[model samples]
Target: MSVKIRLQRHGKKQKPFYWIVAADARSKRDGKYLEKLGTYNPNTNPATIDLNLDQAVQWLHNGAQPTDTAKAILSYKGALLKHHLDGGVRKGALTQEQADAKLAKWLEEKAGKVDTKKEGLSKAQEVAKAKALKAEKEANDKRAAAAVEAAKVEEEVAVEETPEVAAEETPEVVAEVAVEETPEVALEETVAEVAPEETPAAEETSEETEA
Candidate 1:
């Protein structure tokens, strides 16, 4: 029976999680597994992986064939390298202590790289968030300025319309003043004409009496 190292799908749609497993080659993809090695979560920025390194190496040593994606996962987690080192140790090409030391050093370097990547991603996220906030603030400021300008225009229009309304009423005021003054002027003229006519008639009567 051929055994294969593969991944079993789990988690929700679009956000995939997986279990690294060793299963019979003829078994259904997610149906039966010989042993679960670890888990893989791709929802994170760095793609979180948790693998049992010793178990993975042991399976590789036992001739368990890894699928393409599983191979990459195993390689990334240093399982393949550990298997190779173990092979060298068994072949007398390297001592067990030396192989262990080399594996420890490589693991340290890989961890450092992962840390740097995580830090870079975090910084990028912060920058993007700040930019979004700045854009929103600018949009709000533009809207506020527009509102203020609209208010100013309305006030100016009201000020301009006020003169037109006053101008419209101005004619009525002038007409009233004209009507009040005209009555006084006409009365004075009538009194002057009557006095002149009566004076002339009195003089004629007096002359006739004397005659």
Candidate 2:
């Protein structure tokens, strides 16, 4: 049976993760796999790929036909480079030791590049977090300042209103009290004049009755 290298669909709906595998060409897409090569998760920043370089290269040497996506994955993980080195070994163009050295060097370089990318992402995330925090603090300060200003304005309005309310009420109360005192004072003056005239009449009547 002819063999094929392909990806098996897994994970959940709308979020797909995949497994790279070598399987029989006649098998269903997810039914049976000859060997599980590795896993692929595209939900990450760098789109994670954990592939077995040696196994994938072995599968390639055994004439396993890889699907396009699987081939790309193999190429990205240096499996294709290993396959090329194995071919060079077969043709006596290079020794096995040289091939291994070259592969090791390449993997080291790739690892360094991946590390650099991760560091860059980490720094970017830190900067974004700091910026968000600063913005939030600034917004809170503005709100607090606005609250203080509003309180001050309300206090000033209350101060302005208190005097006006007192001024408006005081005059009406004083005028009503003054109007009541004016009537009492007029009646007291009239009673004093009548008392003087009655005293004089009483004295004259007493003198006349005695005589």
Residue ranges of candidate 2 with Cα displaced over 4 Å: 172-211
Task: For residues 83-185, write the lDDT of model 1, one tens digit per residue.
Answer: 9999999999999999999999999999999999999999999999999999999999999999999999999999999999999999999999999999999
TM-score, each model? Answer: 0.80, 0.79
Total backbone collisions for each predicted model: 0, 0
Clash number for candidate 2? 0
Model 2 CA lDDT for position 57: 88
Decoy 2 TM-score against native: 0.79
The residue-by-residue lDDT of candidate 2 on 156-203, one tens digit each, is: 999999999999999999999999999899899999989998998999
Worst 10 residues of 1 by lDDT: 9-18
